[model samples]
Target: MSPTTTFQDLQAAFPHWTIWRSSADRLWATRNQRLTDAQLSHGLSHTIDADDADQLVAQLRNQEKLATGLLPQ
Candidate 1:
């Protein structure tokens, strides 16, 4: 499958985030919900960006870990 299709799949899998590619071809995902100060203190953010789909997915997964308390902030 093409990268665009993979990205769409990622977007579907991560409904809480809005995933897209920039004009410069960078991958980005923005959380649907705003982050509180505590969450920010925990190293969570409202947005993430990567050079490619795989990196973006990895970052998204890390964000999930942070959200679920699986990883130290």
Candidate 2:
């Protein structure tokens, strides 16, 4: 194919791919929530204090927000 043709094809496909990947990411997140919660809980067990729990939760929330923000818009 011509370079222009390939460029146009990519211009069309890029958004679709972005949407597909985003949906997949969100689906994975939904499916993983319970496992993630359990893992977080298990990890927090080693913390053993209210301050530690708060710190853990805060850090996790910040990380999650950062992760979500990094996803395609």
Per-residue C-alpha lDDT of model 1 across residues 4-25, encoded as one tens digit per residue: 6586698887888998889988
Clashes of 2: 0
Query: Pick by lDDT: which candidate is best?
Result: 1
Displacement of residue 5 (Cα, Å) in model 2 is 58
TM-score of each: 0.84, 0.26
Give the Å shift of residue 39 in candidate 2: 20
Runs of candidate 2 exceeding 4 Å displacement: 1-51, 69-73
Q: Write the per-residue lDDT of candidate 2 for residues 12-73, one digit (tens) a residue.
A: 53322211113222210121123245445444221211123234334434434544533343
Whole-model lDDT values for every prediction: 0.82, 0.31
Stretch of 10 with least lDDT, candidate 1: 64-73
* Clash totals in order: 0, 0
